[model samples]
Target chain A: GPKVLQIPSHQIIDMGQMVTLNCDPVSNHLYFYWYKQILGQQMEFLVNFYNGKVMEKSKLFKDQFSVERPDGSYFTLKIQPTALEDSAVYFCASRSGTNTGQLYFGEGSKLTVL
Target chain B: QQQVRQSPQSLTVWEGETAILNCSYENSAFDYFPWYQQFPGEGPALLIAIRSVSDKKEDGRFTIFFNKREKKLSLHITDSQPGDSATYFCAASGIASSSFSKLVFGQGTSLSVVP
Candidate 1:
C-alpha cells in the first residue's frame, strides 16, 4: 500500500502565529486532500488540491488557510495567525483517480494552538 | 445537514463474536461508499466499500451490506479480535465528471473487541 507522510508529527504553537503542515503524498498520486479531526469528532473535509489548484473546499477551510504544492513538492496547509479552534489532528490523504472513493492517508499532524 | 450518520458511538464485543456497525446517508447522488478504520496514532485506512449498485461486498472477515433504497449501510466484522478494535468510519462520495471526488464521512463508531 502506498503511504503519505506528514511532517512534525506534533506541533505546539502560540495562538496568532503562523503554522504550516506538510504532507508528502504518494509519488504518483495527483489528487491531494486535507481533513481535520478534533478530539473524538468526525473527520471534516477542509480542502482538496489538484494540478496546483484548489478544486474544492469546505466551510471548515477558514479564510486564513491556504494550500499549495509548489513544483510538485509537498502539499502544504498553511494557517496564518492560528486560532485556538484551529487545534486538531490534520490528516493528509491522496487518491489515484477521481472515479474511485478509496483514499490513502498519512499518520496525521497534531497541531496544538495555545 | 450531515450527509452521513453512524450509530453506536461505542461498542464492545467479545472475541470471536460478530460486530455490526450501522451507517446511513442523506445524499442521493452518492454512488460509492467506503469504510475507513483508524487507530489512536495512525491515520484512517480504507477497510472495505460497497457501491449503490451492489447490496453486499465482502473481503476476508469484513463485510459491507448496503441498501440503496434506505440509503443505509453496515459493516460486519466476523470473528472479531482484540486486534480489530478501532474506530470505524463510513464515508460516501459521488462520481464527478473528473476522475475523483471528495468523501463525506460519518462520525466514527468506536469498537472494542475484548478477548
Candidate 2:
C-alpha cells in the first residue's frame, strides 16, 4: 500500500507567524491535495496540484495560503500571517489519477495558533 | 446547501449488531462516491466506495448501496466491533475539466460500537 507522510505532526505558532506544512506523497502518484478540518467540523478541500501547477482550489483557500510541489520531493502548503481561526488539522492526500481511484492520506499535521 | 450530506451526527450500536450510515448529495455531476473512516488524531482512510454506474458494492464487512437517480447512498457495516468505532465520512467527486482533483466531503458521522 502507498503512504503519504506529513512532517511535524503537531505545531504551535503565534497568530501572526508563518507556518509551512510539508507532505511527501506516494512515489508514483500524479495528483496531490490539501484539506482542512476544524476541531469539530467537516473536512474541507483547500487545493489540488498536479504537473507542477495548481489544478483546482476551493473557496476556503484564502489569499494567505499557497501550495506547490517543489522538485517532486515535497508538496508544501505555506500560510502567511496565520490567524486564530487557522487552528485546525491539515491533511495531505495523493491519488494515482482521478476521483474514481483510491487516495492515500497522511496522518495529518495539527496546527494550533495562539 | 451542502454538496454532500450525512445523517445522524452520531450513532451507537452493540458489538455484534449491524450499523448503517446514510449519505446524500446535491451535485448531479458527482459520479464517484467513496466512504472514508477516521480515528482520533489520524487522517481519513478509504473504507469502501461505489460508482454511480453501479448500485451496490461490497468488501469484507463493509457494503455500499448507491442510488444514482436519488443521489443517495448508504454504508452498512455488519458484525460491528469496538474497533469499528470511528468517524465516517462520505465524499463525492466529478471529472475536472483539466487535470484536477475535486473531492467534496460530508460533515461526518461518529459511530461508537459498544462491547
Candidate 3:
C-alpha cells in the first residue's frame, strides 16, 4: 500500500502563534489534499492542490490557511495566528491522476492549541 | 448541510454475524462512493468503492449495496471478527471535470464486533 508521511505527529502551540504541518506524499502521486477532523467528528475537506495551484477548497479552508508544495518537495499547510477551533488532527492525502478516486492518507498530525 | 450521512452512531454485533452499516447522501451529483475503515490512532483506509453505474460491489467478506434512485448505500461485513471493530466512514465525490474530485465524509459509524 502507498504511504503518505506527516511530520510532527503531535504539537502543542499557542493560539496566536503560527504553525506549519508538512506532508510527504507518495512518489508518483499528483494530487494532494488536506482534511481536518475534530474529536469524534467527520473528516472535513480543507483544500486540494494540483499542478502548483489550488484545484478546489471548502469553506472550512479559512483565509488564514495556505498550502504549497515548493519544488515538488514536502507539501505544507501553514496557519497563521491560529484560533482555538483550529485544533484538530490534520490528515494529508494524495492520489494519482487515474480515475480510481483512491486517496492514500497519512497517519495525521494532531495539533493542540492552548 | 452534511452531504453524506451514516446511521447508528454505534453498533455491536457478535462474531460471525453480519454487520450492516447504512449510509445516505443528499447530493445527486455525487457519482462515486467509497467506504473507508479506520482504527484508533490511524488514518482511514479505503475498504471498497462503487461507481454510479454499478448496483453492487463485493470484495471478500465486504459488500456494498448501492441504490442510485434512493441515493443511499450500505456496507455489509459478513463473518465479523473482533478485529473488525473500527470506525467506518462513507464518502462521496462527484467527477465534474478532469480535475481531481474531493471527497466528503460522513460522521462515521463505530462498530464493535463482540467475540
Range of the 10 consecutive residues with the lowest summed lDDT in candidate 1 chain A: A94-103
Ranking of models by lDDT: 3, 1, 2
* Residue-by-residue lDDT tens digits, candidate 3, B1-115: 9899999899999999999999999988899999999999899999999998999999999999999999999999999999999999999998654458999999999999999
Worst 10 residues of 2 chain A by lDDT: A95-104
Candidate 3 lDDT, A69-104, residue by residue in tens: 999999999999899999999999999988778989
Tens digits of per-residue lDDT, candidate 2, B10-109, equal 9999999999999999988888888999999889999887878899999999999999888899999999999999999999887432346477899999
Q: Given candidate 1, what's the lDDT at residue A61?
A: 96
Question: What DockQ does predicted model 1 obtain?
Answer: 0.77
Determine the TM-score of chain B of model 2.
Answer: 0.95
**lDDT by residue (tens digit), candidate 1, A3-56:** 999998999999999999999999888899999999957999999988889999
Tens-digit lDDT track of model 2 for A1-114? 778999989999999999999999998899999999998469899998889988788888899999988788899999998999889999999988643557789999999999
Listed per prediction, chain B TM-scores read: 0.96, 0.95, 0.97
Identify the CAPRI category of the predicted complex in candidate 1: medium
TM-score, every prediction: 0.98, 0.96, 0.98
Best-performing candidate as measured by DockQ: 1
Which candidate gets the maximum lDDT versus the true structure? 3
